[model samples]
Target: MTYPRSLLRAAVLAGMTVVVLVQFAAQLVLMVPGVLLGMVFLLPPPIHAGRVLVSRWRRMFANWTGRTVPVPYEPPPPPPEPDEEGLYRHESTLYKSPRFPAFFHRLDWLMKDPATKRDLSWAFWFPVLGLLPLALAAGPLLLALWTWVWGPPWGLPGEPSSGAWWATAWTALWERPAWLAALSVPGLVALPWTVGAVARWSAWLLAPGVRRPPSAKRVEQTLLAWVRCAMLVACAAAEVVLLAVSLACFGLGFGLGLVFLIPVANSHFRWLANMRRQFAEWGGVRIPRPYTPQLRPELRPDGLYRVKNNLYKTETMATFNANWQWTWNDIASWRDLVWLAADPVVTVALVGAPVAAVVYGGWGLVFPWVWTELFDADWSAWYGAVAGHRTLGLLVGLALVAAGLAVPRPLLVAHAWWTALLLRPTKAAAAEAALRERVERLTQTRTDALDAQAAEVRRIERDLHDGAQARLIAVGLTLGAIERLMDTDPAAARKLVAQARETSATALTELRDLVRGIHPPVLSERGLGDAVRALALDTAAEVNVAGELPGRPPAPVESAAYFAVSELLANATRHGGAERIGIDLRHRDGVLRITVTDDGDGGANPSRGTGLRGIERRLGTFDGTLTIHSPPGGPTVATLELPCALSSPKTSTS
Candidate 1:
């Protein structure tokens, strides 16, 4: 049953081969005219049609083979959207109508997609390669039919056979039964194998992502490295021209006293240097920009702007002068000039030499052999012939190309090192940058801390007004009512007094609860470790407390750490579905460290939860840090560290 089904599927695939051939032909016919006539809109339709056809084939193949083939194309770009001015934007151009922009975008999508090329290649090759399996599947069946119709063993009754070449050949085969059986048996045996082969062939090109073999990946990386080397060489040549322009600008600006050109040259060409700095990452080095912060002119009390000792009525002039001074005084600006001058020389030596060797060796020495051999041209000094020997030139060219391929990656690293030598910030500049970053972080954390404090104050005020203060006012009103009722009705006044007493007790409880929120008494007296143990007793999950501190941390640090741990435990129980949790606290080297580990469904992220972010802000006020490591499964570990000195332990007095 399986054999018959396999043979039938193979036969169906063979029939589908004709459809593939027609589609391939139609694509070529459409593509040539589109290419010649500059009608790009004509190109995408046929390619799109071919993609649809191949996609069906991919689905059929997957179903028969029981192996999935994912779609390889990137998602199509969204339609052009109107900007704030109500004009549609595509690339840099603003369009009044989206029609042309949409058309061009679709054309670019079809042309640039890698799957378009793969689909076209598959269409052309599938029809050609499908022939072998077609024969394996349908050949034996056709032979048997021919024998049944024209030969003696199973000849059709009263049927006249013509003397065509194919008919006579089948007649001869039927007479020799052994020859006929030998031909039919193998194709029948190999039918299932043919189906497997077709499935494998389709998957080879149709699978998504990095399904290509490792050898192909290596070849791709090598080619990309060579291309990068060539690009670096080209950039080197461009830098040489820029260097010459910079020299001219410097000479004219300083020598002729036309000083405006100095800033103009520096500001205009600084982007090229920055681009190289970014590109250095390809060679495994990071070169940060070394320029100092831009300086701004200060506004004076007299409504004039001050740049140095000069005051100007208008801000624009003062700003220009400030920028000029800033650029002029920066040491990095001079380093930029030095790099522009030195880079062309260094790049040409390290990167350009090998690239040029490959280009000249391949095109000059090896490739010209085609002209020499086919066109019978003269082989002389004009075309990289060595001592007029094309053979020797070919060998040397091969050697040079091999040497070029072997050295590009190493030389790229060397060039990056040279770039870093001049482009990276000096030690003093690095320190200044670090200081600036630290100041910015401190400013942000200060804002967060102040905001949190204000919110806490508001919360405390609301609790007092709505809960304790209101309850106390009710108690005072009840006492006044009891005093009024004392003379008229003694029993009613006694009941009122009892009600007032109960109300006062409830108000006192509310006040105590509010005070506990402000500062837990357990944390103040017994310290953080015991406070956490008391917290654990209230939590639903089983909580284990371990480790001990030699002495208590500062009151503020202890409060923040306790709240952080409390939040973690609440999250573990409520959101994490945790069954067990552990808390460890220890002080080492003036740093209070607490780690909370939970056995839960773990994917804890600080960015996703306000509780975690609040904890971070609270800790940041004390220059502490929180680190969370929670993978997808169980066991989330959150570590909190605060740098502070511990005070002496408080003695317990009974």
Candidate 2:
């Protein structure tokens, strides 16, 4: 799914505003540090590094502020590329953001200010120093209030007749109405000062001419800016609402969200924050998700699983075909089963004698008489010693309980590890599914192309025999009659000749139309470049083509490409209501990429449109693939990729 640049900008700006507001508000209490920590993990390495520098300086400033405020900062390391995988250092929940480094860096740059420095020391220590009293008093004052209100007299704790003098004294001292007033005073002053400093920094950071507009201009722009901000805020709100709904759904059903729900939620929040900051900086906004966040887990045995049953069962094409999904069974292969067994630790534990001992001890304790009868010991004495009010026995009993709980953890972990190890091959089967999918896609595309060609051939043959050819045959018959009649009667021969000419013209026109529909003759004579231009010129919508083609391609290749463009444009004009279209064709690294983009009412569904289906079919003949990028918006792009060398078009001029 994709969003329009304008609405996307607005959504981003709104998110930035929210992040800033939340950060500032949290600073008033000590919640800012956690949020900052979360943000730091969300941001890119460079911005995080810059923030670290700022943080250190802020701590220095805090020391001068005559207050102790630990301006904390932790710089994240450089990010891994998109495809790299594995757990992160620190076992950080922050790592959950699949695109963390990229996402956060964009956000940090958007949210950063020169006024705060790279470390953000000033922002941190300033808040800490300014709100030190409020921060320090928060815990004790709450405790004092709790005691004063729900003191011993109000509860059944020692049943005190009245509130303690000390409790009242402490409450009066720390929880005074004046302190609340004092707490608010710093915020009022700090708000404007911080805002101004940040604003000045922002003005300096942007290009010289890119200053915030003057009062009059601001007033004029306020409405639009507000609208943008509102839209972006709505996007953030939508994210939160969707997250909650998804969580609720997960909880109600199989609880797929349980294993990684918190992490997913955190990652999503970070993503939204990053998105918002970028938008806000650019004076843009983002909109709520047009499509639902439907992330079904890809089946993997070792990785997180969606369901328990899918573990043992193999994957089948039928499993995926029903829902257009590739299931665990379909991808699961015998080769991966060996890795599965080797990876799981279950066998090792089951063979160990220590595990058996622990299990026997627990079972024997449940019915001590059985052990006593077997051992010929005094069960009652042993039970009394443990249960009686005695020092050694009581301690021993507690130790036994502690040991019972403690011993199980490592053993359970080992068991799970072994089980998972045994299941490694199954997991490998799931992981290899992507490779299988790539192969299948190639095969399917080629099959589709063959089918399309067969259909096209049948169509052409039908048109020729039933239409132009039959008409031409009649013309030939008329000419033959005219030739014979010419010797007998010249006037009659002239009349027959005129009738043959009319039939000849009609047949010629029909043949021309049929040829044009089959594969435009111009495409074969000129090449893809001129063919596309011609096709675009015929369309009502504006077309902008970019990229240079090197020499002419094979006839079959050019024709297939031309037909694809024609079909896409046809669809755009007939159903899309698109005003403008962009066609980009490029040959890079020995592969041909054809991209067709349109700005119109989006939400184009491939399943519902034959034009797109035909494009897919055509590309399939060459083992090429079509990818649709359409959301409910004003723009959509359809991309076609083909292996130039592997797929040569098949056709017969005859």
Candidate 3:
């Protein structure tokens, strides 16, 4: 009962094509049934039930193909989540516009083609005439096949291969009235078979288990569907007749009929195709797969056969039939189209001078008398001889014509360039948009990072000032009091002194721990180079630091660079599985560049950890940055750049 969408589509297209061919052989009268059959057969199923039927059909197909072939239907992609404003945004224009929906709905109605009222027989007459030529073109292939299978004459080449003798006898009969009335047996058979095929197709289309009628709830729905289809067929038939009459009446001017035929015929065919595909889909028939679109022109020459090949070359035709018309929505695509249109105009202008010269030169030689008559010039004197042949005049005339043709190229090119410029997006607008997005992102990141860092600093400062500092002050006061009491009461002083010693030791340890927490003493004493060396030495890493500053930089700059380098080295050793590290430092023109590179398992993402972010934030204060380059394999490089005065330390304190 139900068909695959593709199968229905194919049947509809195939049937429409066959009907069109029949019309081409016959006349407009035949096109009515063709249209009716196309619409009735191709009509898609209604919504809810249609979806259920399609799903069931798909499963059935999957099973039939032994699961090798995939289900025919591809579920629509999930819709985008609603934004903060609660407005839903769809990706396609079809979802957004009612006009497209209405257009397609009208097409569906035209395709359904229910019979509410019958059209006058004359209405179908013209379509038959229009389809006649196309049918004739296709007739030979079928006729040849029939002749080969059945001994109906029109036999195979070289000798009477089956039906040759019978065809000859029938041809002889066609010359007489009785024989003509009887007709060639082969012709009669083929004609009846074709017609019967069409009628069967139309009847099958009208039957149930195929396209169902529109819902009965809407009073005018069924009637309207029928009327719309009738109107469409009538229009198509009338157009065909009008075109024929135009050709008959005006002769050469009949070419203009295509203007009417192109739009209407294409729409008709499209409607027919959709219906066939839909019905076949409902009826579980498999349609041929669609081709991908061609993004570029093919390499073949643009001759008739080549063009035909290109048109049918799956992808190329797909691209042509697709919605690729250059629209103003996307500025880049529109601009390219503008430039393409403009280029010919520009070339024509620049080509004019040379073309004019050639034309003039050639014309002067052939028509010298005309030049004299038209311009009141003496051609004999132009030859510059006593018996002049107007050679000079001829040269000038030819030059003038050549110049006239040559002058237009540049003008045309300029015009074309101007037109393209008009279509092109303004750089200012694009730049402004980029700047806005950049600023917005940067502001959000900077604000969050700063807020986090400030909270951390306040917590550290409070710990040091309140807890450690207070304990140290208490210990100092106790020791001072014990010193004063030692002279006055030796025993009491001794006891006080012991207690003071215990307090002093505890306070001293706490102070040292706090100071270490604030900033490593090793870093200050030995400088960044030694701190890194100490880290590598302790961690058992093969660390190499080349181009270490011979002297320390400004304290803030040195501290920032040292910490940044230390963090990278630590990360590389811990996570990178790095066997070796190479560190480089250079100072030039008030800028310090430090690079720590490692040969390790790479693919390190800075966003995944705070180590890199901390390094970045520290460098931010001094207008510096840390850049990480880690791809999917080994060898990662971390570069830290800071604006500072670079110098070698004269003394080593650590």
Supply the global lDDT for candidate 1: 0.81
- Residue-wise C-alpha lDDT for candidate 3, range 233-274, written one tens digit per residue: 343344444444434433432455433333232222233223
* Candidate 2 lDDT, 1-654, residue by residue in tens: 122332332233334444434454444344344356664443344344444444443443343233444433212223432311242222223354446444544444335433334223334433433333333324344444555565422332332233555444434544344443354445333443443343334223321122344975655454443334334435534554645654564464345535333323223333443343344333223222121122343467654344333432334422333222221133222212232223223323332333333333444343453444333345555552455323344455445544443344344334434333322234444445546666888788767766676777888899999998899889888988988888899999998888888988999999899988987777766668778988889999999988756655556766778888888888777767898999998877767788999997665655433456667677777777789886544478888887674233332344
Ranking by lDDT: 1, 2, 3
Top model number, lDDT? 1
Q: In model 3, what lDDT does residue 581 have?
A: 91
Candidate 1: count of backbone clashes, pairs at least 3 residues apart or interchain: 0
Candidate 1, position 372, lDDT = 64
Candidate 3 — worst ten consecutive residues by lDDT sum?
114-123
C-alpha root-mean-square deviation, candidate 2: 23.1
- Winning candidate number (TM-score): 1
Query: Between candidates 2 and 3, which one is better according to TM-score?
Result: 2
Could you tally the backbone clashes for each prediction?
0, 50, 68
Per-candidate local distance difference test: 0.81, 0.51, 0.50
